[model samples]
Target: MDVPLPLVPAKILTAPTTITQFPDYPKTLILEQCKTIKDLNQIHAHLIKTRLIHNPRVAENLLESAAILIPNLPMDYPISIFEKLEEPNSACYNLMIRAFTLKQSPNEAILLFNEMCGRSVRPDEFTFPCILKACSRLHALMEGEQIHALIMKYGLGSKGFGSNGFVLNALIGMYASCGEVEVARHLFDGMSERSVGTWNSIFSGYIRSGCWEEVVGFFREMLEMEVGFDEVTLVCVLTACGRLNEIELGEWIHEYVVAKGLKGNPTLVTSLVGMYAKCGRVDTARRLFDEMPRRDVVAWTTMISGYSQANRHREALELFHEMQKTNIVPNEVTMVSILSSCAVLGALETGKWVHSYVMKKRMKLTVTLGTSLMDLYLKCGSVGNAIEVFRKMPSKNVFSWTVLIQGLANNGQGKRAIQFFNSMVEKKITPNNVTFTGVLCACSHAGLVDEGRGFFVSMTREFGIEPEIEQYGCMVDILGRAGLIEEAYQFINNMPIQPNAVIWRTLLASCRVHKKVEIAEESLKNVVKLEPMHSGDYILLSDIYASVGRLEDALRLRNQMKERVIKETPGCSVIEMNGIIHEFFSEDNIHPDLVEVYNATENMMEKIKLAGYVPNTTGARLDAEEDDKESSMSHHSEKLAIAFGLIRTSPGTTIRITKNLRVCMDCHNATKIISNVFNREIVVRDRNRFHHFKDGSCSCNDYW
Candidate 1:
């Protein structure tokens, strides 16, 4: 069945001539009545054709109708039609200002106001609001103040749209954004007709400047005044709570939202999750996430970012995957969380997949995304790939260069890392504190003592970037590796900022290297005091005692850990092949090819022992009967990983192993001997530095 078109309204279909017959004519008309500008021009032609151009009411209606469509119709045509009218009325002027305001042509509207006033076609109640709106749109405070003066002079301040609360609120918002908050407050206070929006504008002003306490105070005032809370108010309040970490306040807002029946609003829900997570209440965030009836990109993104911030990388990865399974398109923020999770986990294959996903989705891979990808690659022990990504980037920023330099340092290419830093400087780009920290750290890892000193001075003198705590830590690492334990300690004493745990630990490690017993005791105590919860503190302290032959003190420290009931985090190694990660632990013997792994490990041990290798127990707790800890060090994870590699691969293959802890001196020594005896190269990447083992030598010159 065919549907018939509906008849148009007769009022819309009829003409202005009916007004005279009806005797109750509208004083003004809208341009939409003509249906087309051609029809409108024809009406004007008929005006002149019928000699009704002198009819005052008809001329007023025609000009007003043309001005009504000024913004919507061609601007030039509206101006032309308006010029043809013998005497355009104030109604036409009002429509023109409204039209220009809608078109975002505030300057034209202001000029039109001047023209109207010149002709003594005085503005009425509607004129002031449009003028104020124009001033606000241009952010012209001076002009806005002039209009405000005019408003007061015409008594429009109390009479018309000037007294309208929303218009007043717009003025307040403009003034606040222009850094005239006091003026805004004055206007707000003087309002005889203030709306709730007036208060919201002030509240948002505080939020923009990170003034959470003021936001809270204003919100309280709003509550006390019984001004109804809206969604905008809730979002702002939640944002303030998230920044301040006032968990109790945030929770109260949550309950308020629920009571107000706004629980399921997506923006409110997302903000609540963020607020809870930012306050370190991940459980509450999870509960809200679980209860959300519908999840948008913002909700998923908030959960993913929350997990990332809380260091729950596994959950972040899981949620990202879930988002994909549900067909919710991930935005740039979502990708950042997923990339960060991969970086922390060193999930290279998955990161590579994400890069592919970026390409498939036609994402630009902007500098931020590219830099994050490089960091992920570096964390995954793929500096070559990071460098490649950096080189291919369309635009590079300081952060991008810093990540590359740090990645190189992380992967043990100290010289190359320094080269990258030098290139960054030569590019006329200034290096930030993070970039210098990475470069200096590279020099430390390679035992480039002179280079470290040079860069440290250059950082302050040339770049004008003062050495921060991390930079100080790197210098200590350098000097300590050069057997300058006292110098490192003196450097710490002279530091501008207080030395942190890394500084104390770096000095302690050097003491172990140089067998500096006395300084080691003091450094160890300071480290434990600074970071008692850090397992590395206890472990490093124990190792220094063992090196100094203080067996009793070593045992006492271990017993103190026992008293505290602290369990050591065991070291583990992982490698990805064809997409799956194979995890190996020290002394692990559970591989399906366990027999082969054990036999290969024994043979390698015998070969290295023949090369004058001894299990150097520098890292053992001295209190443990010497042989027991020596045996334990022999079963370190890197060794087990290399042995498994030898059993599975052919001879002469370069073995690579990454472990979760600092490689003890015994493992370091053993790897060097094994690399020499087997006539092969090996790379051992540990928590602190990388060891390139070849021909009974290491890249660190046996200092690290």
Candidate 2:
């Protein structure tokens, strides 16, 4: 059965009349009715055949229809027609220039403007604004200044033009976009009369230059002067508010939007959401996001990113899931934020899903998105994936290289990390302070004290990069970890800058490892002076006392902690299974599967002990019985999380866990034996670094 074509209406089916058919009919009216290039071409053919192509008014109208009116019409069609013209007036030149700017060909617009000048066409009010806009788009400051002089020469300045706000607004925008924000501001301040557009121009100018404080101050000035603002003006000020985290002013803007009935604009609402989110008020952002009658991709992304920035990763992931149910597709920025949340939560499956989506969408692996994905893989203990992401990147920046190096260092691939640093230097990429920090950390983790020292000095001498506190801390770790405790103490004393508590704490941790109680006491005293009420310092000092068999001293230190009501931060471990994250704290008793998990933990402990896993109770309380000390050591957060994973997950599946604090010696030892006994691989990410356990050994070789 053949399908019949749908019948057409008589008006659309009728053959269109050409200019030759009705010589008296207005050709411009026919030009105005053109809905496609074919319709225009028919009229154009008639104009040429009837010798009406030479008529300036008729030809200019044709150009207007082709360049501006008709949808999807190529600009080259009008350009070719204009070139064939014997002479075109200001209107023809202005049409082409404006069309060029709208089509994102600013250089062509400037070239046409120069040709207009060569022909001595006096630029009208419309002429300058179009050309200035072109200059602004190109960031051509020199050409913009030449045009500004022309504006002044032709009496188009504020003093001369009287009320031509468009000209002044373009001037402001051009100067600002050209990076001459001060000049833009000077023009704005000199205006005897100002409009909302004038304020928006200056506001956008300041924003472009990162002068956010200036924007907020001027917005307040606008309010004081009782000026009216439109959606653009409000959005500009709200952006400044978001960047500066000015919540009070942001709230005020929200109120004004409501009172003035401007809440109907989605852009203003999204700005309010962004402002509140940046100010650490995700609840308000979420409320505003929910109240939106319709949500766009930008709005959804802003809200999701807000949760991520607040360190509320679970909420971020939840909102992302909600966004997935909507028709709006997540953009590159949204994926980056989701990946960051995944990294912090150790959600490897979720991160992998996002990666596949990016590939499915055929989106470019931009530097930022690639770096974010690499960070996620590294933090999730997917070292192979991280390396592949780094390798496949189209281009690399210093930060990209730094992330790879730091991630490798954190994953216990320290020697390879240093080789990458060397490769980076050989490629002429100068190491910044962060790069040096990663390099030094790599050396510190690999116990390369001499190499760490060399990099520290070379950072200042060879690269001219000054050592920041992070590098200083890494150097302390390097010295202390290598049993050079005396030199580490002397290094702290001889430092130019004041040592922070972290540096002292690093020294103190090494004291616990080497049982240097006398130096540990000195480090503890300095740490106390810096951070009074720090529980870790007291705990470290007490452990040092117990390690040296000074049981009475250890008891007294514990008593001092009790008298001060100081509480240690409990260990926490996070594991992800079936795309859901589970958290376990020390001696946790609240999980729904607590009974099963406890039974599994007890049975595993028995098996590990039979496999020669002896518990190291050095940090346990000296006042407790030996059995009680060993019992306390058995229930660390990572162990419980591991037990839960082993019981719930299928056999042969790798268990990846992230802990809040560094893994204790006893748990580290037990995890190795567990991996061997169960014939499964286990990856543990503690506060310090990663421990990949398999077949009765760890990647760190028990040094960490």
Candidate 3:
């Protein structure tokens, strides 16, 4: 059975009045009674109409009546009533200040406090707490201290009610928020009285300051002292748990939350799901989400982002569609997660839908959304749309700048990519290692080895960011592309961090490019061991075997790959067809355009041959028969696609092709020949590198 949420009871304190004699009731006694707002307002209206509140005692009654009736209302109405008096007493002014402070306009409270001076009415104990409240909310430590000095001057410091729970709590909050934690603690410990709010403020301060151990220890101390947990405490602790990657503590908190029936609170549930997800337990996050009684937009967003961070991109997209099944609207956070999913999966259609949705719904998508949109288009192989999104953004942060730089770099616009990076530095928006990674990648693709080295050194010296393993991979790729094999290898060895699989693969690919078969074999072992789950290492090793004239060993490696227990990543390619795009890969040939593509390819092969394109079989086995080597190079999928693009498009039309693997040297040569013969430009973005073929030359310069 579903239950209802907690309800807050309305409360108002009425004015002191004479007890009336009714059926032997006490005469002239103090009247203390609760009255509704209408009852109180009627009395106030009568007093204002009659001008009877000119009496100090009558004015005090009206002030208390308004405080009781109007606390729920905005302070503006109450302040107007208080301001109307030719002059109100100390109590009247204090209530007005307190009301304004609680209404979130504390500056007005302070300004009013200044106006109270030189008035005949003296500020009593109530005025100090009220003014201190304004100071606390404003985070005006200097003003709070001044108020503190006044409290001592007025001799209200030691009075228990003057230095009451609310006033002391505000002082603690003010000190903690201003980073004076020790002072805050000293005051807290010395206080004879503390409320639940007092304890919560201190615990929250510890969490915000990243004092994780203190957070844990204080939570325990509170429990030991018999202070119970609240939603705010759980939220703060769970946030700290996520940052600390404390999955065990996170689970304990989740269990506690579930037992206490706190799971219905969306904020707590969101925090728990996010905590589990951030701790690398997306499955646990989903489990928690499933058990929850209700879900808000934040809960759904947390689950979506959890899948994203875990790289379960398909699941993320699935969640996005599922969220639409419910009435809850997707916010900017929801769009951010979906955009990340699109970026990972290269889902251009889904990304386009989100872009249209943003426009139609008039959702105020932020700069992060714009940046992710640019990235999604680029990853989906739509550089035109990526550039369009980039131009539309009003402002660009480092991520925004990096996306465009990376997009241009990925599209083989290296000179423009470098120029963009230079522009980023000039604008004083500091670039992170990820930005430099893109620039370094561009240099590697463009064979800007000198520039790569210069940037590599400057990234450390100028920015103080120590290079990570990926940066080392870029340096090796830069030198490797230039055929400076030994220098690339030496640079990897000199790296402070251990080289990962990508670093070794860069060296091996360079060896394949330069036909240095012996070195390729040595590098292949490291790459294979580094990522044993992936079969590209084995495939690459076999290619080196084929290049070195060891056809038997190449076959042996292929057989070993088949026999290995681990599954290989299937080969894949996306093709644009009709008004939509289709993906076909790995022994699958069901594309509608397949027959047309193949026939066109057959015709263009002849034209390419007539143009004097000699397939470079140096990447094949050295001892293999010439016929076998030539046959393998002839029907490569990338070459087939390039030929199809050439014959299917117009004479001068630019051919844009995307492949799932690095376009081989033989295919690169064939593409260059076709580009020159057909008098067209061909842009092929393949796995591992990009190639811009034009006038019998490639942007990779035949190095990749």
Say which candidate scores most in lDDT: 2
Question: Per-residue alpha-carbon lDDT of model 3 for 1-704, expressed as tens digits?
Answer: 88998886687667756323321221111123425455456555655666665766666655665554443755555666787788787888887787677777889888888788756566776887678767766778888777666655665537644466766666676666666678778888987777788887776656645677767777778878998768888888887788788888888988898798777788998899999999998898899889877898999999999999888877888888889999999988889888887766556668889999998998765688899899887776577888888888888899899888888787777788899899889999999999999999888777788999999999989998888888888999889889999888788778888888889988987886676776787787777778776777776767777776777888887777778865555545544333233454533466566777667666776788888977788665444689887765665666555655555556786656656777666777888888888788876667865577889898666656
TM-score for each predicted model, relative to the true structure: 0.70, 0.85, 0.67
Which of the two, 1 or 2, has more TM-score? 2
Candidate 1 structure quality by residue, lDDT tens digits, 629-677: 6666767777777887776657897666667888877888898888888
The TM-score that candidate 2 achieves is: 0.85
Clashes of each: 0, 0, 7
* Top of the candidates by TM-score: 2
TM-score of 3: 0.67
* Residue 449 Cα positional deviation in candidate 1, in Å, after optimal superposition: 2.9
lDDT tens readout by residue for model 2, 140-241: 999999988887788744456434688888999889887898899888878878888888888877777778898899888888988987888888888889
Arranged by lDDT with the best first, the candidates are 2, 1, 3
Global lDDT of model 2? 0.89
The window of 10 residues in a row where model 1 has the poorest summed lDDT is: 18-27
Q: Each prediction's Cα RMSD?
A: 9.9, 4.9, 10.7
lDDT of 3 at 603: 72
